[model samples]
Target chain A: MNATLNKPTSSTDVAQNGANRVNYVTPLANILESKDGYVLEAEMPGVNKDGLEVIVENGELTIVGRRAVAENRGREVYRESRAFDYRRAFELDPSIDTTKITAKIDQGVLTLHLPKAEAVKPRKITVG
Target chain B: MSIIRYQFPQVPNWSSSDRLASLRDEVNRLFDFSWPSRDSGLFSGWSPALDVFDDKDNLVVKVELPGLNKDEINISLDKGVLTVSGERKQEHESKEGESFRSERYFGKFHRSVTLPATVDSTKVSASYKDGILTVDLPKAEEAKPKQIAVNVA
Candidate 1:
């Protein structure tokens, strides 16, 4: 796992943090590779922009989402949805450009754009 | 009660009972998953969770279904029982790249539950926002809880 990958790996690794009130599950995600960069999408329902956290630490990319269920504090006749927190992490290598990583969330879905480092990106070779 | 598959690889040719009649009593015990425990293996099956509750005025059900379109959701209430069903498609087509690790589930799913109070079928409405589907079932006049005033000396 230490070797640098030629293509970015799809981070199917999901993590769930210790929640004080309710339990949670890891959201589903899809990862795709493009010429310029790699894209990661995650499904995080009921989470707002303020509840999302994306961090890069020690070459690891971590995503955490916390959805507020304060409104659901009322009486409950039946409850099945975990209504808790979400977390996921991925290991990155030197080939990825961490500074330029961009992400957006729409309709409860999150998309992260991880660009490849300039040196490692494929370049077109011309005939001599 | 069972682990749902992400892909509809095959469809059963026949059904013994009415497609949803069995759902009548089984919905109550549908999602008793032992969450909060760490999942094993590289990829785990993904299934959206739901919650159903009621207040003084209305009964509500909320489902976590991110990346799903409004057209994909369907809700039906009959015989004091409510059903919410839908499908989430794999967002992308099968590409040529090798899958490092796959864990997301896609396919059809339906959740059914019988409600405690009789609801006004005509006044029911649902709204989807931030990937959560909220179905509001207004309680019938008799089903609504009445707050009685107390007279103090």
Candidate 2:
């Protein structure tokens, strides 16, 4: 389970060219466990490389994704909702090595690999 | 969209994390102020939020469905109603250790919207990119806006 964070998008400071648009959403995420470590995956559909931010500080991890605004065409008759920028965070455990964490964003899914600390990795045991 | 659990009428049990997420959703709703949220328990798993908007020439339908594969989705147009149905499989299970937090929703979901009769179903086209599915339905010739020249009457 990962903690859902309300932290603002760290990459928001990066200048973007848009008329006037400010929308946000909490991106959904999934955490899976593996032998070597854990994998954190978050779905941020509209975000690209330049509009994404991932940070880990003080045992907290935050993923921020800013969606590129689309150019207005004619009119909006009905609006279920806008695909807004997404943001979410998770608290990290002491057993996970933050420095070794790696991330890759592909097809809107951001996958972060958190390697286990040396002491937490499972070891094989042999008996005579 | 808030999942309306009929079984549990009152489950406001909010953790700090879940509270934050719901708060953001509230703020989003406050700014947009769109009516008729997807709070109805039409599906027990999850309901994807979608929009049906029209431009000068065509009507467009966009649905937000992240982490869902394109092949898993099915879109159909029958009469004047457009239906989008899909399944998001739960691909993992926890064997040990208590889950710290989890808010991700997964399972099969079906959503449909009735389109205007003006929509030309023959010219309907859909494309999925970045997890957002956009379906375009062109307007029929008769439904298009006509500009009439008015001389000194």
Q: Which structure among the candidates has the greatest lDDT?
A: 1
Considering only N, C-alpha and C atoms within 3 Å, which residue pairs clash in candidate 1?
Answer: A81-B50
Instruction: Report iRMS values in order.
Output: 7.8, 7.3
TM-score of each: 0.72, 0.72
Best DockQ goes to which candidate? 1
Q: For candidate 2, lDDT tens digit of each residue in A16-125?
A: 44976554566666666665777777877766677789899888887789776765634655454544577766777677888999988765677788888888888888
A14-109 per-residue lDDT for model 1 (tens digits): 233365333345666676665666777878888878888999888888788888554753467655455447777677667889999998887688
TM value for model 1? 0.72
lDDT of 2 at A43: 77
Residue by residue across B1-153, what tens digits does model 2's lDDT show? 443312221223223574466457556656664456553233245667666777778888887777778898999988788999888886666775334334566777777777754777779899887677888899889989889998987
lDDT minimum window of 10 residues, candidate 2 chain B: B5-14
Q: What share of the true interface contacts does each candidate keep?
A: 0.53, 0.42
lDDT of 2 at A4: 33
